[model samples]
Target: MSNDTFTSWENLVKKQLKTDDINAVLRKENLEGIDVKPFYTDVQQPLVNLPKIEESTHLVAKYHESLEEDVFAFLLNENVENLEQKTIFVNNVDLAGHISPKEEVQYFSLIDVFDEKNATVNDQLVKELLAKQFKRNICIDIALHQNSGASISQQLGIALAKAKELTEIYGTEILEKLIFKLAVGGNYFFEMAKIRAFKILFNQLSKEFNLNLTPYIFAETSLRNKSVSDSENNLIRSTLELAAAMIGGADAVYSNNYQIGNSTDNSEEISFKQQIVLAYESIINVFEDASNGSYYVEDITKQIAEKSWTYFVETEENGGYLELLKQGNIQKDIFDHAIEEQKWVEEGKIKLIGVNLYPKLEVKKSVEELYNNTEIKPVRWAEMFE
Candidate 1:
C-alpha cells in the first residue's frame, strides 16, 4: 500500500488484493438497467455533456386553511431567496382568488386547480392570468402523473411531451416561464438521476426546437411512500426526499402533509419545519452538484435520459401527448409501472415502516377511513399492504 505503488485504483486492487476476493462480490442491476457494484475503483472523468446541479433551492411551504395564519407567518418570515409557496386549491375560484398580479409563490396548479375533468383555463380568467409576469412560465407538474402512477422514466417522457409542445407553440420565451414540479420517491440515487435525466432530455429537445432554455425544477415528497399508520415515519420520508431534491439540483423544494386523506396540523407542521432545518441548520446545501462526478449516478442519468427520449419520440410518432393518452398508451404504461411497484410492496420487497416490515399489532384507522378525504391523490404503495 505504498504511495509510490499506486498508479491507478485498479492497479492498486490488482497488486494488493487477490482475484478470488474481488470476484466473489455480486453485482445488482436496478430497473434503470444500472449495474450496482460492491465497490467502484475505476472512476471515469465527469460527464462533460451533463449539467451541474447547483442549489438555488427555495424552501416551499404548503398553504393550509387550518393553519393559514401560521403558514403565512412561515412565509413572511422566510427569506425571499429561500422560500416559495404552493397553494393547493380544490377549485378554480380558490385559484383565481389566490393568484395575483404579483406574488412570491414559486408554483401552484392553475391548469386543473378548479376541477379534475375541466383542466383548461376559461376565457374570462385568461386575461387576468396573462396580465402579469408569473414567477415562471407555464407550470408542468410531472409530480401529478407520477403520484397518480407513472414510473420514473414514464414521468420524464410525460414531462418531455409538455416541454416539447410548449416550446414549439410558445417558442423559447416559454423557457423563461417554465417550471417543473416532480414527486421524489425514496430511492436516493434513482430519484436524483430522475431530475437529471429530465433536464438532459428537455435540453436536447430544446436544441432540436432551436431554443436554449434551462429548466427551473423542484420536487415534493412522493405520496407513494407516505403511511397513515406511521405518521411520524412520513417525516423521515420527507427529510430523505427533500435531501434528494437538493442533491438533484432543484431550484426550490416544498413539503406537504403525508397524513394522506387526513391533513393534520401536526403532520403539516413537522413536514414544514423539516425544510427550515435542511436549509438553515444542515450543510447539505454547501455542495452543489455533489453527484456530478459519480460513475453510477452519471451513468444512470444518461440511461434514464436515453430511455425517456425513446418514449418521447415514440409518443410523438404515434401522434403526440393527448393522442397517446386517448389511445390508452400513456395510461397503460403508467398503470403497469404502478402495478409493478405495488407488487413489490405486496411481496415485502419494498417496506413501508409501520405498514409492512414492523407489526403494528392493530389497525390505525378503518379501511374506509384510510381512503382519501382530500382531493389530493393517494398512492397505491401504502394501500397495498393494508
Candidate 2:
C-alpha cells in the first residue's frame, strides 16, 4: 500500500479505538502519560488569554531570488539598498555554499576582526564590517566549531568572550546595535531551553556593563544529527527541530535543505517549502508563547537556567570564560557531553528516527565524497583561529 493509504488506515483504526477510559488504560500500563478526554467540560475551559512573551524579531533569508538572469536582475534592483535587511545563517563555506562572497558584502558583512594575522581576526572582521555600514546585522558563527569537538561551556564562553572583545574594540555604543547569531543543535527540549536561558543570561550580562541591548536569535535545524542514509527521514527530523525553535521564541529559523548534508540539490526544495508552509500556510505565527504555560516546558526552562547559570558561575570563578577556553576545559566538557549523548542514542534512550530507530534502507554518502563532488568546503573555525 502507498504511504498515504497506510496513514489513512491507521487513522481510521485510531478513531475506532478512541475511548474515554484512555487514562485508566494508561494507568494499568504504568505509562504516566497524557490522557485524552471524550469531551471538555465548561469548568475546565480557560478563562483568560495567557500573558504573551514577545517573539524574536529575526528573519532568515535563505533564498533571495532565482538564478534566472532576468529575474535576478529585477530582484537585485529592488533589493540593492535593502539587501542587508536579511541574513541567513550559512552551513558551509564552499563555493556552492548558500551565501556567496558578493552577496555577503552586499547584504551583511562579518562581525569579527578582519586582520587575517591577528589572533582576533574573526572579531576584527566583524568590527570592521560593522563600522563600514549600519544597515542590517551580520553573523559571526564562532559556535559552529563547538559542534564537532568543543564543549557547550566552551562554546558559550567563546561566544561571550568574542562579543565582549568586540564591544571593547568597537565601543559599547556601536556594539549595542549589532546582533549575535547562535547556531544550535537538535537536542530538542535542551536546545529550546538553552535559547531561553541565553536570553536571561544575556540580559544579566548587559545589566552588569550597563549596556541595553536585546539579542536577536536566529536558529537553524542542526546538521549534526542528520544521516546520509534514509535521507528522506530528515524531513521529519528538521520539522521537529524547527518547531522547537519556534516555540522557544527564535526570531527566525532556517530549515536546512536536506540534501545539504550530501551536497546535492536533493531535498532543498522540499525543505524550503516546509519552512514556508510553517510560516504562511500552517499559521504557526498566529500565537506567541505557544508553549508558555506548559508544565513540562516551564519546568525545563527553569532547570536549564539553573544548570547554565551554575556553569556560568564556574566560568566566572575559573578566571572568567575566555581563560577557561584557553585551558581547553570548555572543549572537554562538550566532548564529554557529546559522548554521553551518543551513548544514549545507541541504547535507545535518545531516539533518532532514522539512525537509532526506524532504520532506513541503506544508502551511503560521505562528507568527503559529497564535498569533492560539489566542490564545497565545510566552514572551519580552526583555520580562522590558526
Candidate 3:
C-alpha cells in the first residue's frame, strides 16, 4: 500500500492505543539488532534490482562413501529424470565417477578451512578443479558461520571478505566458477533476507572491481536448532528452512537427513521427498522472484545489506578475513553470540518446541562444555539441555 494509507492506519492505531509513540509498541528487535515493524508500506524504490533466476533450484543429494548403489536406488525410486540438473556433494573426486561426464552435474566439496595451511591446500585443489573445467567448482563456504551461531550480518560480512580474499588470489576469472554454500537456519524471514542481501552486496562489490558478477548461491538446512531428543521437530524446522531458501532465490538447496536421530533406513529418501514435495507439490519453483516487492522482505533485505557491508568494510580495514581468523577474532565473535543464544534457550526466553518446553526426559550437560573450545565449532542449540 501507499504511504498515505500507511500513515492513516498508523494514526488510527495510535488513537486507539492513546500513544504517540507507535514504534515502541509495534517494533521488535531481531538477533541482528534490526528493528522489525509490525507493518511496512510499499517502498517507492527497491534497494536492489534483483535479477531473474533463470532456472529452478537444483536439489542436492549428499553422496555417502561406499553407498553408491543406495544413492542411485533412491534417485531412481523417486523417478528423478534429469541427472544433469541435480547437484551432488562429494568429498573425493573419484566418488563422482558413477555419473557420465556428459551428464554435466555439479559437485560440491566440504573443503571447509579456517587456517592458512588448509586454505593453501584447498586453494591449490580448487585451481586444479578449475583447470579441468569443473562447473561451479570453487566453493566459498560460509555455512559454518551460521551453524556456529553468527548473526546474519556477520555471516554475510565474513562471506564477502572471504570472497574478496579469494578473488585477489585467483583473479576475476574465479568469479564465474564460484558457488557460495550458506546454511539456512530457523529464523525464517531473516534467513530469507540474508540470501537476497548477499546478492545485492556481492553485485556491488563486483562492480568495485570493474566486473559485473552475479553469485551462484547454494543453501542447506542448518544443524544448529535441530534437537536430537525431539528429532521430529527437526523435520518441521528443515521444511521452513527449505521453503525460505526457495523463496530467497537460492540456485540450489539441500536438506540434511533429519532421520539421524531415528532410523537410518530410508533417511535419504525422506529428505529427498521433503525437497520434492516443496518443488512439485507446493510449486515454489515457479517464481523467478517470489519475494520481490514484498514490503517486509524488501526492508529487511536493505537493512541486512547495509549492516553486512559495514561489517565487510570494517573487516577489510582490519586486514581482512584471514587476519581475523589468525587473531581468533572471528571465532570469538561467533562464540559470544552462540553463548548468549543458548542462554536464552535455557532461560526459557526462546522456546524451542521440544527443547525448553515439553522436553523429553533427559540428562542436562554442563554449559561449560561449550566454552572449552573457542574455535569455530558446530553445535546444536538443544545439545546442552539434552
**Best candidate, lDDT-wise?**
3
Better of 2 and 3 by TM-score: 3
Off by over 4 Å in 1: 1-25, 43-45, 49-55, 64-94, 102-128, 360-378
* Descending-lDDT candidate ranking: 3, 1, 2
Q: How high is the lDDT of residue 63 in model 3?
A: 45
- Give Cα distance to truth, residue 134, candidate 2, Å: 3.5
What is candidate 3's lDDT per residue for 296-362, written digit by digit as tens? 8998898999999999999999988887777777777888888777777777776788777885335
lDDT by residue (88-187, candidate 1, tens digit) is: 3212434444445236553333342112223332434433444445554356677877786566877888788866665555465656565677889888
Please provide TM-scores, in order, for all candidate models, with all chains considered together. 0.77, 0.64, 0.85
The global Cα lDDT (0 to 1) of model 3 is 0.74
User: Which window of 10 residues has the lowest lDDT sum in candidate 2?
Assistant: 69-78
In candidate 3, what residue range of length 10 has the lowest lDDT sum?
72-81
State each model's C-alpha RMSD to the native: 6.2, 10.6, 4.3
Candidate 2 lDDT (Cα, 0 to 1): 0.48
Question: What local lDDT score does residue 315 receive in model 1, on the 0 to 100 scale?
Answer: 82
Cα lDDT over the full model 1: 0.63
In terms of TM-score, how similar is model 1 to the real structure?
A: 0.77
